[model samples]
Target: MKKQMLLAAMSLAILSAYAGAAPTDKAADVPLKPAAQQTQAAVWASRVLSRYHYKATPLDDAMSEKIFDRYFKSLDAEKLFFVQADLDKYADAKQKLDDAIVGENLQLPFNIYNLYQQRFAERIAYARELLKSKPDFTLDESYQYDREKAEWPKDETEVKDLWRKRVKNDWLRLKLAGKDDKAIRDMLDKRYANYMSRSRKLNNEDVFQIFMNAYAMSIEPHTNYLGPRASEQFDIQMRLSLEGIGAVLQTREDYTVIREVVAGSPAGMSGKIKVGDRIMGVGQGSTGPFTDVLGWRIDDVVALIRGPKDSTVRLQMLPADAGPDGKPVTIALVRKKISMEEQSAKKTIMEVRDGTVKRRVGVISLPTFYMDFEARRKGEKDFKSATRDVARLLAELKKEKVDNVLIDLRNNGGGSLTEAVELTGLFIDRGPVVQQRSAEGKVEVENDTVPGLAWDGPVGVLINRGSASASEIFAAAMQDYGRGIIIGEPSFGKGTVQTLINLDRFGQGDKARLGELKMTIAQFFRINGGTTQLRGVTPDIKLPTIADAENFGESSYDNALPYTVIKPAVYIPAGEVKDIVPLLEKKHQARVAKDKDFQYLVDDINYVKKQRKENMISLNETARRKERDQQEARAKLREARLAAAPSPDDPILVPDPKEGLKQAVSPKPASAKAARQAAAVKGASRTDDGLQGDERSLAAELEAEKAAKNAKDVLLNEAVHILADEVGLLKTDTRLASRVLPYTSDR
Candidate 1:
């Protein structure tokens, strides 16, 4: 489901301006249908939204105006492309957009898009012309990179000046990085060309998706229109089973970047690919010639890499920080199905000693609430699931006789709502887990009927802003029941539900394939009556975190559902820890007040905030170089101080000894045959390509060893201390223990 969700939003990448050598008069006749002629799919999409959207916004003049404004903003958020005149010229279409959508007329949007393309082309030509001459870097000026709130350029001349400064800054940055003039120009030329060529390839479907999405998103931020390709990709991702290299790919500049490698998958286990590595080329099998993928469409690259099970895909990649002169490295991986093991619940036991007494706290880190729905439907006895895995892990922890359990849900973005409810059942007896309110104001209570409790011991659930939807449901449920103490940062507030509606399903036989609509149809609320919409579940024990609510939470989204409360559900409260919270908080405050790592984190966050406030960097070459040098010197000083200081005793403050080793070494395989096959592929590829595999392996291992020494986690260590404190208090304080355990009457 995570993968499907990724693909659904893949096509939403901003189409950045791509400058190239001046073209012959703005390619005026680039083919496109007039905007007034709406496709059957467009009409079907509009109808679907009106009937099924959670926020039933009317497709009227007011909505049309909003969509018009949003669509243009989406095209040029930075205000670099279109001028005020362009918007003014298209002003009449603002009110007519509502009529066009209802009347199944798309001519207005298409016309707007056509005008945008023309201006985009002209700007690219102008930018390319400016790049022909060297830029003046001696001027003491600042370039405002963020322009979301800035007004549009007043005229073509103003936009040209902005581009000139932008190009100059780009050139200066490369020059400061020690690149030769020729190298800088070559790289810039290629990047610009790639941008232009890619933009030129945008067909009607791309325009339609962009426009329709603006409309749907005006209704609610999560609601979107995915084109045919994006829809298919989303479906494949939802299966959570794919025969591919298991790397998330995105296009940045001219290179196809590896955004992430799924843990326990072929790419991840290979230890050859890294996040941000640029794939220069791809090959199939042993003998296939590597095809240069520069300027290629992202989907094209994705299709080339994704193949049948047991097949081989070889990636020629440049390291993330590589310069223009950097050489590409070859990595061969045997493509296989990325299984649930990568994202399943993982358990670790941490020992915290209070003076003479020692306690073992079990930590279960669940990345996402997931279940193989198709596999379960097929009657597979051991279909991998979050609830099932957590249940097994809980039993294991109990067997180990741990005093308390901490469920680390940090960075969990959520999946499968049903699994969230079932997983919540593991900690407590069945009851209403969450409430759902549909578009028609119909409320439904989702209950967990399972009677058995997995771990009724003292529990702590850790969360952060990355935790959303299903994560919030479980956290809020536990907090309400007094089943556990909530810790860490407040969660991501995403309370609404999205249902994927396949437009193809609505069409008759032989209809042109319309994409899918991820329409928001309902909002979820906690059993305690509050919705984790704009305001998510607040932790009882707050930790130092970099997540700012205004910038990072659901409130960041323009159309997110507001925080609201509903009638509380009838349920029994297990107990409350209002009395114990202050003590825990005091201990946390005292520990972090002087702790070196915590203080350092606080300083770093403040520095980042300061940098954000002072957003503009000096465009002058001398000033920029001096600033860079100062930063480097400070970084070196900090590094030396850390090296001279004694290592912290807590694992959270101290680096993980095996952390770097995990990344360097191949992940432990699920099957011996799979491991052997991977080994065989690596050996065969090395021999076929005449590569020095041993030398590379040794270098990677040595680097990993060095990095592993520096990987620290103060957050986890602090969480352990908090839990240990809870255990100690529960044992010594009768009142605290009484609130946590079953009441005397129930017993």
Candidate 2:
């Protein structure tokens, strides 16, 4: 008999259950047996988790039940398939999952997955049949697009009805986009066929990965099982480089959408691709026939796009906001290597004049805490690292006689752990930056060994929800030590530490290479006895964000590790900025109230929030058209209002070598002379007009500068204003000087 151990790692427990979902029609029984390698992987993964995972959750009835529910949810999150009857059929496995793991019997999960695949195929067929007839656009019904909270259909008839409405909605959306009936029908057919094809391609490994992740994620959202393909992708991303289009891709429903276009990359420089645009097809080169990627896996799409540097990859993409009838546009991009220059720390100087104080605040925007570990091991003199690059930026800023420094960590998703520690060291002299508490109750303090500070000045840290891990660590430490004032939305609360364990290291014989496990091995704690866990580091000064609080942050994840506190590390606080912050906040509030752009930002955020709250959309074509028209009208009105708003006073002519702040006057509204010259050129009467060649180049340069100046970041402008206030406050308050001691052991 296999021994069953009750491994209770954390005393805390989540009280809530998974939301209730109604049942759909039962799926036809499909028997499944795990492949030999899959069984071996399961057994090995279980042992690894027990020995290495921070929260070694007991693989008992409780865990098994959670895994069962999670696995089903993973299969059909929108409650499209698998009714109560199917759940009843898999009831034995719900509790016996623990036994299966221990006895190395992986048949149960595979069996459930096989049944899910069968149901998926049936649903696709039903949807295809429904698409045979055009949807009635005159109906005044509403489709609950968000089905996560809704119950599954009770029977085949109900499921078919839901699918009918879904297909109708899909057709209506395309029809509204101006697609013809024949085109809409063809598109729908292709889409359904694609989904069916993808379902058919699902293998035993794919099923195992999905089930394994469900089990792992139940312990903590960050603890994940990376299958071989996913592991390789993770490694590529970690390298801070890849030879590709330089855009992150993710699957949404059936389309592969661009998540983010990396700066300095071909796609970003081209300025053709935008976030949320869906790629429908990809071409090998300019001449090659386009490969329709509809219903393809994200990995497969990535494989098609990523190729040799300087090679051309053509994408046929649909704009995110494009209607079903919207025509796809082809964009040809020359693939290039994503270099460290794209991800490295960059510097700027924003000269703020608050009543003639002339505050030259240095802005260092660190995109990631990156370090070329391999280069360092090879003993390269200039091995690229965040700390070294930042240190260099700081020195340049000092040479420019900057009054204060603002570290912009917005959207920095973190990288090297060692870099976060070393980067923190640059700001303060010899102190504990972050503490790591391991699974076996071992506390390791990562300290700043250097005794002298690289920067000792009034500092500000700009953060947002995208700032996570290493970014959070640096921000939290600065907040805890009172070394810098944090501005913006709360940071992404990811305090737990993850270690990627190679399964191949433990394997033997033919079943060796079994992907990897990115398990939570420890949790990080700030010097002030607080963890930047679920409640990420809240900024000292808050900024209004358009992003819904519910849809984002660490707390949004159901299984995120809870926040906890421990004994504070022995360290001196930087100073008391608590009292002065209110003053800064008051000033900030006053400035933004009078600022037209700030008002617009707030209005936009409110508009987005209102739209997000609305889940049910009308199916009536007239109603949707009218609503869309009204929205467009409102947007146009806002645009007109902004255009009428007064432009900033003529650019400050003080030449400050910082590229971002060069004085560039907006071009005068097109001169009559230039217009007349354009007409002359059209009539072949002004071949030697002044607006040609060198003059034309100068005109383009001026126009580009004007555009850049107009698009200056309003939030960063406010941050500079706040930093200017902080600098002013420090200068005026004499008693405050002793309290705000420059990096030293003295209190």
Candidate 3:
């Protein structure tokens, strides 16, 4: 099954910045050890997690105290550099890290990563000696920048007053983003000397990829280990080619964030780089100099934002809805490549009126369940497949008669489980579409011997929290065969199933490289037998998103993998969307309570869940400039009530039923008085590092036209008005349209 349909396409796109040759600041001052093939790759990754881990867990002593508190929170995850007496001097090596990963003993995780590189070079030499001076912005202190779950400092004078309120919250976030005080002390002394030259370039394969991914995520969270330079960036993201600026990066502490932009690459068509932004300076072409990358190393800021495919790089960023007193911006882009036709599956359509009846709906989107499996193993009769381009966009939306389709799969994050069981046999006309099991128990299923129905009308899927794992196996087999209407926000539960392995083919002849593991040998279920693992696909219409499910997906992985059950397989019900979901949730909650853009997206998902539950901030500069001027006066009154409302319709494109109707136009609307006259001509061209050159290209063209009018897909325009109110209640309910239509006697 192509190794059980290889699916971990989680795409953390660093594309090519991890396979060795980077240690030269005088070989980053030596010290880091254990690389003679990482003690037999940590005893062959602790006997492949005690023999093939589909959560057979057990590396005892409570998984070595959860791999010694996930290797000191993967080396200080903001509990800021070691203190509870440096974790009570290895608190007796927390039950001996599972007998030092089954006796290969990498000297207590390289002496707790050499005392977290000596308390991260003594907190970057006390934050470059508190950037020498200025920091009394009218007292009234507050910092606690969400120390993950706080607690550590009970010594070194409470860890130098938590690095003096983290260098006064990094000089009150560059003095509320306008800098000056000698440009925030020359950018906090080159961002604490690029955090002591990236914590003196942490080597020994970066402390054996942070103690074998803190003992492979303490036995679960998708068992990893990758190291031989992240197994060559996981085989260059499984051959979905690459080059650069297609973003997807992580290392959060000293920020290099921006996780996932990629879609049509050049950082997703430069909608000015988003996904929790951050980057903080890279710069190369058209005036190079920038560099600062806060504290580098997300593989050296992805090898300084990888280059050469049509050059230029730039970046700077910060945005993710501003907050650390915001204003960073910059951008630029250019680099290219990223295409599997920019992660394939396309289509569009939308329409949805209903009063005088406009309906249409189509959509498709997909974004990853790709195939090209080496051009279908070289027999290439037109290969690149997401089920042969969504079965040719469901036969060109059934020759443009498009009544209702949808799909989308929100931020997809999944790929080829045989193209999610051949794209769930294009709207099910067959059986068993997903069940797996493995780690020896054995189950299997995966059917759909492709027969008919590639667009069994009135469908809807969508999904959010970044969909996931074969997009939770095609939205849990279209919510267990009542084929479609699983709207939004729930899916990323990643029901197990990883595979990789390779450790240089168990290196017996000692070629030394030994890397890849990925592991989690199979789990997914749902052919009615439950288990989208830690509870994913729950959407018969649960919209208003901004991600929370206990803080973003797979139940925010504190060692994920739980919700079980299995044994239903023999399938059949391809119809009945739960008797029209309470009349499509009473006409989708009376049109989202008179939708002012879905109440400005439920007031921006309740102000991002009240700023993710307020983890303290106010380092006072007049209460942080009156909370950044009341968040830019509630974002200029939600962009002047979305520029006095009434916009939403424009989706059209879907027409290639042999090129019949093509003119769809749209883009040209940024109003709120041209974003308050591009914020008063970029506030008279701000300087201390805010806006520059052609006023930062007219503030990145009014922030890519207010991020294309806040990327209006308002939950796929309420899943196209709930699939056009289920195609206007199945055109006067023919027994709920003969149990959910689809047998159009060969159209």
Candidate 4:
């Protein structure tokens, strides 16, 4: 009997594994008719669920057919990337799915669905039987998934831990409301049954969502099909704050690792919890050995973390990266709600200089393109969003008389499409900002309908691999229109539009349950005809930041679409750089050769790449200690070269992070603070133009005397050399100096 039970368990496990999903493409062998395709898709969906031993949905084979009929028929061939062969294959697959759904000779559909249905019914019956007996279980009340106060279920002893927590918590709530345990349990059980039954009938979405996300990848990363449950989860991810321990977990090899802890959150406030921490165990409250959960799925782990806001839940975190001690780290944190506003966007100022020329550049650091979608859906147009804040900032900058601006869109994942269009229009005079194409072969241009341009001065856009979607769109359009200069590394490649559609709406009484898929509906293109989907925009003057090619780049993504260009639209270039390209190139080479920052950046990149390449790396103490030593060595080297500000007694040093004051000073931070970083246009128009021997010689003699007085030491000498070269551009045409400089003083 024992051996028989073991064998049966193994067989059931195997069946459940297949239930998760029959290979993603099960219709490959059989061609599907359009109607049949719906049935096949439904059947395939059922098979996927049954393999996982999950419950069945209300959706049936007939319902599946109707959903596919609307869905597949809606496909715009012109919008798809399918070639002749691909289209033919797609058709065949659809036909096969339809045939399967139509109750044809399909082998897996009926059996898998029926088997899972029975399995679900058995679980429910068991629960019903427990209720019938009314065993002396705890009168517990807790919200397992719905609320934030739920606790983690420790072991097999707590498989129905959620039930225990929910019942206990619900009972308390009812008792607080003057109800008895009998009445409370009855109500709570009713609610539980209702929720589970509805969820079990989620054939359209819940069980097969990962595959739906797979479909979103068919267009771009941003296009996603979110199951209802997944949709709720995605909302939390977007806000960057979860009502949990505040630790970000990711799949590394086979184990889930703590990516980073949100500072000031309950987990982060512990100080002991750090980035790269691995969570091997979790304790429900605080009394016993932590429960081992090394092989749990990411979603399961997430469910474990979230609890009622302000409720206490201890976490057992393993040390992340080794520190000075070169040993393992163990940390405990009490879960708490995270609500730190400090990390959000704010305005800052940067002063640039070129000799005596000074300029103040306004910088707005937007953390993310965020929107309160819920409020907006409630018809609140005045709800807080990025565009309003930015518009206000631009107005403020104008009041300060700031001409140049740098909008830092780095690390900005796109939010609302409305904002992208509105923000892009803020730059150029009224016109189309981007072109959108739909799966229905429909093309439309999203225009900036605003009355006037916000700013007409020089704009420099900085982006990196983290800048994606709306960021890419704005950058590409700005670049195409010759409205701004792009600076920094390439952006993240993601430029697709997604839409949410409910799958369960097709029919009533279906046995299958499924959710919405965020599928790609269209691809966006610059008005000038280039898609920012896979190949992000190229910057005019690339700066060396940590986000350069090595640390984060487009090469990291899977199934990234190819970069291609279409016919260009007639649009004016942002700036006339007739001779600027060669000039900028020359300047770049000079800076690259001498800039310590650039050199340091190169070394850092090489080191990172080396670490990434090495395999079979050890995580033992010896290797860890060596890494710490290497890091210390780097810190020491950096400290030695750090630019320091002069004391009150010494005025020679300039306080500037980007300005290498020690290496070269006089173009003080204050002087060139506002000067654009572009290569200065050269000319033979000298300030000291031709004058009689008396005037010219007098001016020269006076200039020499003043130069001597100003030239105190090394920094001054270097500054003098640079300024002289730039200011004396026309001096070589020595005579032109006479024509230009004579009126300088009088003017």
Candidate 5:
């Protein structure tokens, strides 16, 4: 699932702007009929899914209803455009979509989509009319922005009222950001105009993709249908060469939102673009005028961002944390290929002090389980693999005389099942890493055949909500074997395996391309018999995180596979870490109770939860301004407190593959008085500084760097300390030490 989503996202990143059927000037004239190949493709897809999909779901009345509801939800997720009358018009087709799919009939789906397009056009036209005059911001009213669960409007009048509040809220947001009325009106006019223009570009292929995906997801979230263009892009990504800004994008409403930044890619290196940031405009070269991208298709925006290597693309972005009153910031990056080396495992050392005893703990950060399959297939000995890289790092850490090793797998969306098994071998001598169960109930165990311990010292594995698939496999094995203590948040539960099926193979020589289907084939079970399907590997020591598991992981998806258990594989436990987990948890709790950074993290988590629960915002300008002021005041207070606290003396050591270890310079701690002085200087400069273009971009970069320096890795630091506590406990208790591998060093 992870691989497929990334491939789909990267395809959007690398493809040129889609030039579909010539756009008609009116939305009513847009193509609403299925293409010649769609009928055959739909039939083939249905047959393959029913015969071979892992879930064995039948296309009956129950499933047809799900498809019908899902299709409507996809088109109107926020329940903004459609009304009760629109749904009533097509109520009879709710239980017939399944038959439609099998019979290769797509008229109903297309007809519904055509009506949606008309409603969408009417809404945009209304919004454009609303923008002609300024809204009365003094009215004390609130807008419910998130209406995913809200009922459809009973009448057109009700929807119009909803739009009135929406438009008012939008205008007030800009006003609070210090934009004048003229600028706000002009920007909104262009935005709504773009919406109308893009709606006319929708073609038959787009409608088919949406309806088919609705059907696919009703069976399983992992299964999806890729159109011909998307399939071609997926094949390109499989070959491992890409040129773009290296960011994954998804359309949210009318905006193209950044979902993930590929590490070491142009966008990631810039340190300015981040997940959840909205790309409002795009520009070419160094001095091109920014083109407003609001209400544009996500793929079109991606095309504007992607370019040839060494070319420059500038983006006007709204920061993720910046609320409705936030101003847009521009960032420029040179396009380049995302390098494999950047995603490789990296080693760092953190010195943790427990009272007077200081211990050197080695940290291995694995972003993904990767291997050079082509090179290895060609019998190349120097091919890159996570296990090989980690083994070399282990040898170097041994030379450095580190006492414990912590494997950091946070945000590691898994890759390469073979690499995961081999990587787990680095910690344990040899064992059954994970078990795979086919749809026919056939179980197969993958083992580490060539194994001696790479580093047998005390070990820890750190994970979070973003850690998934192969990452979960490795971490679960480590926990099950008693080889290490698992720490941090529960991982993303995605144990189902997927295989791509080419639809053209079943086309029987028809000239049209039939696209492809990503089908779920099997589920992964841990050595201890439990599957990481809906319930991912739970950490022994839970940490505070801002991400809500209910909204972020596999359990959040509709119709996800359920968790189950099988007969446990015969295997030997490697250590007695489980017996000492209580003591470790006590120590961890005691340490973080007094840690100010930890408290700040808890506060942020609470704030996010509260905001998510409310879902409504005041449209009154005064209330909005007051809320923004309170937020800024709290942030400043936190900064002051952080400035007043004593800083850690230890510097992080990053190992250079060619030059051994290099000490990273830590940011100097700032005193409260110094922080105040710096703020004053910044305030004074804002009045006189007339910085423009590249100079302004440089200033933004510097500000981002300063913010990054202040953000501490509270979780990783705590993990290091917990490992140090374990090492300390083992040195004094001979009985406890006997049950675990004795720390050894060749130095």
Candidate 6:
């Protein structure tokens, strides 16, 4: 089911908050409901404990009492089964156990554990009943394109209701999958057995997470407490490839939906799969009747999607935004292992101009601060990491005569502590990149080493809510140091460092235990004085996106630690962005008022919100067909826009720059028809809209193309005019920069 990682931002209002999100009550604070005052399982547990462990003992009463306390306290009292009546029943069980043990009945703890199984099953049966209830209106938030952190919802109830609906839908989905009552009970029993048999050491981590969440939320939202197992999992998630089709699936309304495809992954590469695509059915192996994966946990979906590498898996995706969503698209993909070498650090160079001056800007996108940890631990000096490769890429781009750069740290979740600090070093002349503070409050400034400033030119750093952790640190440092102009929406505030500890190290017999605890340790502060804690760095020029909402900020992150300030560091003032804010706001407003891309994003968000709010849909074929057509139309419209837009420099250029890089570059197509379309774009580029100064005829041709619904032709014509502004110049001579100046930001 869709796991709601949300919290009410306004709760307690403590800057440094961690679980329940904002600081407040503990497990004991929220008293159990009274209706479950006499739960049978609890009563049975008491009897079992007394009969087995305390039989014939003079201290049976006291022993049974203490054991019972541990038992109830150890249980997740919030599991809905532990109401006041359950507690009373547990107390009765304890008394019964005490009496039974006084008579030396020995088969107790196992029986009690069995009782746990029975009670768990029965409780689930009733919960299934509860789930048939209608779901609440939901406006869910998820990871932003920047990947720093999750965006928050506009309303608290919106997310809370999302969770409720998700749970309810999951119940209905299970029933619809043809699992009768017995099958459901058997499955639950097995799951329960697994939990009980888990290492006690592993289970203890739950308590630690609860405690750390309460403690960390106070510091900041991005600061996470990684109990060991979780940290390992986090590492795997950052690469945008997780052994599946790379779909961000979650349960929404009554369906498990495709949130968004990770860029460059299999799903993202498809161009056909998109955000809001829903998974209605999943066919495993060779296939038969489609098995519904809707309402399943993300983990379960992964299990269903994964297989031996190269094995084929069929997926039924309902494309959102592309159609009305009636019929599902069945896609079969062979699973493969994807590593950072394939997923991150994609770069391109774009040529733009302001009148007669042509400027070549390098755009580099770093997905995450990737590091080959396994390789590093083995002392592989050449192990790849973000800093290592990014540094090299910068050097190469400079060689290619790039005058300006756009470091696209969009969805880069931080990785490799050293890499973040080192990456920051590349932009600044020489100074502290970030600050780290310990629990005792000792702060140390982290300085950038091995840097004379990578490229001192006007730079723009693009970020969004997904730009978290190390990305935030880098952005904050650059902003503080006045190195570049920060663009895009506010970032996800995840400033805290998490340490993962393997429970297997401590629990020798717990190899089967997959869970680990992640705890927060260090907090990040900027060199100037502000912290990237809960409130991540505010960009110099804010760009609007669909990821906005008060709940999307740090305060909305559960159990986020509080924020506190320390002594300000003495530093030099950087350059100012004086009137940039107004410029940005104006530009964004103007764009939002007319830009179709901007409008489409808003529409997509609203559509998702609607689905999350709905209960169910009619499964009629006619309705499905109509929905499908609508979606296809939207998809075509979007594709038309993209196809008409700017095309990238030919990939063949790097290897053969000496082999005629001067002519107009055409778009790459996957097939012959696409190649023909590319040829048409190139043909249209010949008549200089501005290049050879054939402005009149070229403009008329463009206008005619537009009138004829040839947007691609028109866009290519426009690009020709734009590029003609600088025709004969090589990479640098006239097409790039004419002067060198320092890029400084006003912090």
The number of the candidate with the highest TM-score is: 1
**Which stretches of model 4 miss by more than 4 angstroms?**
1-223, 236-344, 504-513, 545-558, 569-589, 613-632, 642-747
The best candidate in terms of lDDT: 5
Sorted by TM-score, highest first, which candidate order results? 1, 5, 2, 6, 4, 3
- Model 6 bad stretches (over 4 Å): 1-338, 353-358, 373-379, 502-517, 548-551, 578-594, 602-747
TM-score of each: 0.80, 0.75, 0.34, 0.49, 0.78, 0.50
Candidate 1 lDDT score at position 62: 88
lDDT of 5 by residue, 220-243 (tens): 877889887676555443433456
Worst 10 residues of 2 by lDDT: 10-19
Give me the displacement of residue 605 in model 4, in angstroms: 0.9
Residue pairs with backbone atoms closer than 3 Å in model 5 (clashes): none
- Model 3 per-residue lDDT tens digits across residues 219-238: 77767787766665555544
What is the total number of backbone clashes in candidate 2?
Answer: 0
Residue range with the least summed lDDT across 10 consecutive positions in model 6: 10-19
How many clashing pairs per prediction, in order? 5, 0, 0, 77, 0, 70
Candidate 1 error regions (>4 Å): 1-29, 32-38, 103-107, 180-183, 245-295, 304-336, 510-512, 641-646, 652-710, 743-747
In candidate 6, what are the lDDT values of residues 119-169, reduced to their tens digit?
444454444444434432133222111212222223434434333443433
What is each predicted model's overall lDDT from 0 to 1?
Answer: 0.72, 0.71, 0.71, 0.46, 0.75, 0.48
Q: Deviation in angstroms for 140 in model 5?
A: 3.4
Q: Is candidate 2 or candidate 5 better by lDDT?
A: 5
lDDT by residue for model 4 (188-283), tens: 566546434432433423323433333333333344444445545534423333456766566443345665556666666777776556666666
Local error of candidate 5 at residue 423 (angstroms): 2.0
Candidate 3: count the clashes.
0
Q: Write the per-residue lDDT of candidate 2 for residues 1-747, one digit (tens) a residue.
A: 111111111111001011111111121343445666666667788888866788888778998998898999989988887766778888888898877877888888887888888788788888988877878889889887767767767777877777888888788767766778898788788778766765665656677788888888888777767676666555453445567877867555667777667777899999999977889999998799998987666666777787898999999999878975799999999989776354568777767676766777888887667666656777889767779989999998888898888898876766667888888888887889999898888888889998887888778998876677888899998888888899998877788887777787767786565778878888999988899997888999998763344655677778777899988899987766676788899999988888766676666566555555787778899997886666667566556755684444211223555454453221111122222322221222111121222223333544744564555455677787898888787778756655654543233
| RMSD after CA superposition, every candidate | 9.1, 12.4, 23.1, 23.3, 8.8, 17.2
